[model samples]
Target chain A: MSKALLYDATLCIDCKQCEAACADQNKLPYDDNIAKEERQSEHKFTAVLSKNDKYMRRLCMNCQEPACVSVCPVAALRKTSEGPVIYEANRCMGCRYCMAACPFGVPKYEWSSLNPKVRKCTMCPDRVLAGRQTACAENCPTGATKFGDRDELINEARKRIQDNPANYIHHIYGVEEVGGTSVLLLSGVPFEEFGYRTDFPRDPLPLRTYQVLSKIPDFIPLGFVTLGGIWWITHRREAVAAAEGRQAHQAGKELK
Target chain B: MKIKFTFWKAVFLLIVAAGAYGTFVRFFRGLGASTNLSDQFPWGIWIGFDVLCGVMLAAGGFTLTAAVHILNIQRLKPIVRPTILTAFLGYVLVSVALLFDLGRPYNIWHPLIMRNPHSVMFEVAYCVMLYTTVLALEFSPIVLERFNLQKPLKVVKAVLIPLVLLGVILSTLHQSSLGTLYLIMPTKLHPFWYTPLLPVFFFLSAIAVGLAMTIFESSMSSKHFGRELELPILQELGRVLLVVLTVYAILRFEDLLHRGVFHQLLVAGYERNLFLLEIVLALVLPLTLLAIPKIRQSAGGLYLAAVSVVLGFITNRLNVSITGMETAAGLHYVPKWTEIAITGAIIAVGFALFALAVNYLPIFPEHREAAGPEAPVAAKAAVLSHAGD
Candidate 1:
């Protein structure tokens, strides 16, 4: 039931409609200068990059189990059941652990503002919840950037590769990357050629930190008991020695 | 009370003034304007040096308290007060520096209520808060004695053993948790520094640096205050440092070997060179200097060994936090001058406050009392009387 976005690189005709629509949907300033930039920033939620006569769109991967959400001390970021990882600005203390933890480097900070907030793709949660397509999906001239149920998109991507094996790559980029992101991609060329990280672990990144954090409950009690035991033994030994010395002094006084 | 405008004091004042301006720019203009930190390089020396190294260097507070209070090594009691003060000051400075680094400095208290049990950072935050409180309590008896508040002093004294135990436990948790912060960055962190045993490495290195810092502080204070150097105790600390450095070196290399990253040591690269430098400074130099009995027994030699260990500790932390991530980040992050100024200012404030505290408080035992072998007995009697009261 979770919604997902499937981006077909071969179908994208360098139209740049998705970029315009995303900027519009997010209420970010979109000008010629901002539009021409090939990077996602606080001012630009999504961007389209052109290389070797092929186009690819870049935005937040919105992982099923987000590293950002796991690392955030304040729980400002959370993964919604509907497939989008959302952030609450009011809850964020701006620790930027999210910025460091994100494997995709998707989160951008409003570093220029006195009161800054981490900015990234929200995946149009409102539109997805209302049963409407995202702005980028609605504005795409071709069916390049399609929004639909994640499982159906996976099926649709598999069919596209099966139908035209010669035209598309055999692999789906997001099907297993960082434990399967909501955003899926189909590329004619290798995903890495489009500057995508293909080296991500198939397992979720949050599990790595969880493995360490889970041991704390066991550690606290063990450490406390050991320290307490040592303090008791040492204090008892001191008291015993002090008592023996006092008895010897009393015996010496009686002998005199 | 007249302040002397000595050469170094004047320089310190200048740095603080520059730091004040940097702080203004940071608050008004934001991190982007003041630092070179970008999305690719989210953390700089603020987190690396000011927070990481600051906390590490302050490990002496727990280590010494544990030694004296828990282990019953009462010979170390004379030096415990100053070490606690340094730790209290160090933690306070770290909090101050974090305010400058955080994007939303005002919302620092959010972690207190908004719980994220899964986050290592959350663990670190809670431990730092709790440990700072424990350190304040551990240090309160000195303040109480200075003000001649007998009733409160007795209350604090009665709880001293439990308080010291709590301090050690808190230090152990956070010191290791700091390493856990980087456990999530396995792909990004260089293999030379990354391992599952990172928390263990962090904890062990913290203990070693804790001892080294005690010696370094003792040496510096002896010279500054025109007091006799506590050579015997410092020499004993050096011997302990030798044992710790040896174990640390063995485990570090063993971990590298176990991970099949031993070959990285032979590679001619920036990371390898930095790794070698860290080992040489942190392990080899201190071990060599402290192993020789004559050198270990000498005040100057012991001081040099401690300084080397301290420097090596700093190098290791910086390498782990900054240098290790450079290739993956795709750029070398050189901290802006404003960032350096702020860090410098924080250190200067620590020194200024320490000097003021030493002048006002009974941080060190009286020369005659410290010189006597009866000092420990006197201290025990004082504690017994407080308990009886």
Candidate 2:
């Protein structure tokens, strides 16, 4: 089953137990005061973004059709069949287009290292594959974060919104955004208030790119034929003009 | 025969020294120390200027070659060799700058052996590689002649037409592909520079810049190298620039209108100001200047127009790569002193190499060769027979 995470902002107390757990799980240094160090970084794969007295986790959404996976020239980043988008350091030449392409701006680069790699949440694939929850979800103290099969998680999230219609926003954050992310979120207020982009097109981003690229086959032949025609016409005209000038000069000499 | 120790040379040396230090730090301490690049701003002026602006500027090579060799514009032949040399040097410098920019410079060849046809960057990598090779091959006849290697010259000459055609094809592919590289960044890039037809815009603007660069390089060469100005050809180039620039300007406005973002142009902000400045200086001013017959004919007028176009292209590219992404990055990026020094050194070294090539090689066809129809063939045959000895 494809694992997914459902994060409910109403339940999160901003304790940051998940942040510490993720850091420990990934072997990165854990910060004592994570609220002061809010955004996700090279060392912090997940962080709770505190805004307007509300808390939200800021990590890779791991899109169903990730722009990073689509844009990586060497296939360094791949969305695993089971779930989660994973990166292989061995194949990465560090172009960082992945950093540019991620809609959430989730990927971070190891800029300070002599050999840098793109850093992001892998969604704890090893733990998930072992039939255990992700480090963050497993460590959550308030049951704010939960992990299970994606379809079941989506149904569970919907059930919460249905049961607490007055308390919840009556909408799932990731069901249709950027063609659906594996990580879903339930919020008390609007998602845009917490810096989440609510204006994305429902279709995957790469589909738009593929639509443009699909026209290349038509463009190449047309461009070549057009360029060739211009070259031929211009050269033919010049050649004819030169020939006429030569003939006129020879005729003038004969008349003289 | 003697070189002078001038102020500019002194300045150049100081920059190279500082840049050498920066490069040292870059290799040792990595990108974080030498550049202003961050997780937020992973690309800086090194990409904005060195790779993007550099490749766009070097476009004169394919454009001029296509005009002369393919379009049968015989008068433009005098400028072709010099333009190609400049382009070859420009691409070489771009490659060097890219090497510094990549975090794993040693694995640069991964793009070559690895196949990721779905990726736009994959296409860009292949095009850059193929086009650079094409340029080198296109440039080799000059070196062969300089060395008086007739047999090799004959062999290279046999393939010259095909090579030029291939070079033009490859140039078109990558010049447009550079824009395609940004297509994935639709949300990150501001709507002002981002359009579905970005590749079209990139291709069109490249043609304009390519032509303008030829005029700019030619005029500069005439003044500095004591070569006579091919005034008529330069004047024709100005007219062509007017046409191409007009088309580009119209397409730009049309794209804005199509996207219903023409109102964005009126918004009171820094991006608006920069966008307006880019349009006025790069497009409108040059177009107005080149449209006048008398102004187009005058050397000064042509030079000014060409310079404006070149500057405008630089601004457009910089805006697309850097300024457009700034808002998305949430914090602004200012290039470190080291970044400036390294880029300056790269340009200084490119100029020095160009000067050296002009001094030693027969880049400019002789005055007699410029006047005579058969001069290029005669000169090559002479070099060939000398090599036969």
Candidate 3:
């Protein structure tokens, strides 16, 4: 029942209807110049980035094991069981560690606010929960952004590549990148040429952090015991030295 | 009522005025308008210099406490009080700097009530909070003594050993955790500063810089406060600095080699040049200078070497936080004049507080009475050793 979006770049005509729809749905100011936004921002969660006469959507990849979710100190950003990654403004302390941790650099901060929050594309989790497509997919004029069950959409993407081997690239962009994102991207050109981060490892980024954090318990005990032992031995020597000196002084008094 | 118009005081007042103005703009206009920070470059010198370098410099508290209280290094006992004060003030400054840097400055306390064990920043926040409290407790005896609170002094004395041990433990965790903050940033962080053993590198360098900072503080205090320099102890500290620096340099190069990025050093590039400068100036130059017996013994030579180490370490932190991530950030980030002004003001305030504490409290450990003009330095050392016991 988990939903996903299949974004076929070949069908996208840079119309930016999705961007307009997203802005309207999210209550952002309408912008006709959506293509001018080369990157996503706090106000512009979704943008159409153009390169060499082709367009690609720049939004949250919505990974299964999101790095932003993992690194958020207050659980302000969460990946729901339903599918999309969502952010809670009230819960955020504005640490912005999520902004740094995300591989795709999806999370944008409201830096100018007296009270700022991390902003990103939520993939319309509320709409999906109501059994409807995301605003972007619902409004795509060319049927480029098709929303459905993740497994089915992924299979459909593979079938398109298989049927049109000469027209499409062999690889599905998000099938295994960063432990598989919920959003699948298909392109005529290679994913990298369209500005996808193809260099990310297959494993989730948090796995590396876990590898280091798992060793903390070992450090605490080892550091305490080692430091404690040094403290005891050093102070014990001083205490004993002082005691022996006291006894020697008593012996001198008795001799006198 | 006219104020004295000394040059330094004028400079201090100007910094405070500029800083207050910057802080006003920062709070009113917000981080976007005030700072050069963006989505691309979320972190800047405030995090690097104020938080990272400030925390490292304050490491003298735990290192000196462990040496004097745990290791029974009697010669270091005299300077323990002053070093703890410096550390306490340093941590306080870091906390304040964080307040300015955080986007929602009011929610800085969310980490206290909200728990997120998975995040390294969670660990850092908890450690910094706990260690600052420990430092305050460790420093309380001095405050109590000044107030003639004999009963409270006795109470604090009972738990002094445990406090020192806890301080060491807390300091070790957070100092390393600061490095762990960047572990998730493997891609963004340049390979030169990025390593699996970054935490270890941070811990080791903190120890080295801790010792150097102690010497740096002691030398300055000796000149201004007219206290004895404790040349023998400072010389011994120099030797330790030399050894720590050597070990740190060896480990760093070994890490680079293991990662198969040794060729990164050979590349004629900006990152490579910065990496070389950091290693050579901070590690190599000071290491070489401190190894010489003459340089270790002479006050001026020791001061120069310690300053080199301090500057070198600061450069290393800046490079890690700023220069390392430059390419990935895409846009160049030159910190706003407001950012520099605020940082300068924080340092100025820290120094002013330290001076106030020194003038009022007994930071120099009854030095003039024990280390009299007639007493030879060796004899004075013996007196202080007995006093420590």
DockQ of each: 0.81, 0.64, 0.71
Report fnat, model 1.
0.81
Please, what are the lDDT tens digits per residue for candidate 2 over residues A1-256?
6778999999999999998899888898875765468888898899898887898888889888988998888889988876789988988998888898888999999989999988999999888777889999999999999988899999999999899999898889888888888899999988887788888878888876677667766866776777778878987898899999999999999999
Residues A1-256 of candidate 3 have per-residue lDDT tens digits of 7788999988999888888898888888875565477779998988887888877887899998888888887778889877899988988877788888888888998887898888889999889888899999999999999999999999999899899988788889888988889889988887777568688789888877778778888987887788889988987888899999999999999999
Q: Output the better candidate (1/2) by TM-score.
A: 1
Each prediction's number of clashing residue pairs: 0, 0, 0
Task: Tell me the deviation in Å of residue A209 in model 1.
Answer: 1.3
Per-residue accuracy of model 1 over A1-256 as CA lDDT, tens digit each? 8889999999999878999999889998888888789999998888999997998999998888888999999999988888889899999988898988888888999989999999999898888878898899999999999999999999999999999999898999899988899999999998888778888889988888788889889988898899999989998998999999999999999999
Once fitted onto the true fold, the runs of candidate 2 whose alpha carbons sit more than 4 angstroms away are A34-36, A217-226, A229-256, B367-389
lDDT of 3 by residue, B1-389 (tens): 23445556666678888999999999999998889989998888899889999999999999999888888898878888889999999999999999999888788898888777888888889899999999999999888877779998999899988888889988988898888888888778898898879889889989988999999988877766667788888888888888888899889878888899887777798888888888877988898888888887898888889988987888888888888988877767789999998998888888767766775666777642243233222322222221111
Candidate 2 chain B, which ten residues in sequence have the lowest lDDT sum? B380-389
Worst 10 residues of 1 chain A by lDDT: A192-201
Give the whole-model CA lDDT for all candidates, comma-separated.
Answer: 0.88, 0.84, 0.84
What TM-score is obtained for chain B in each of the predicted models? 0.94, 0.93, 0.93
True contacts kept of each: 0.81, 0.64, 0.68
Ranking by DockQ: 1, 3, 2
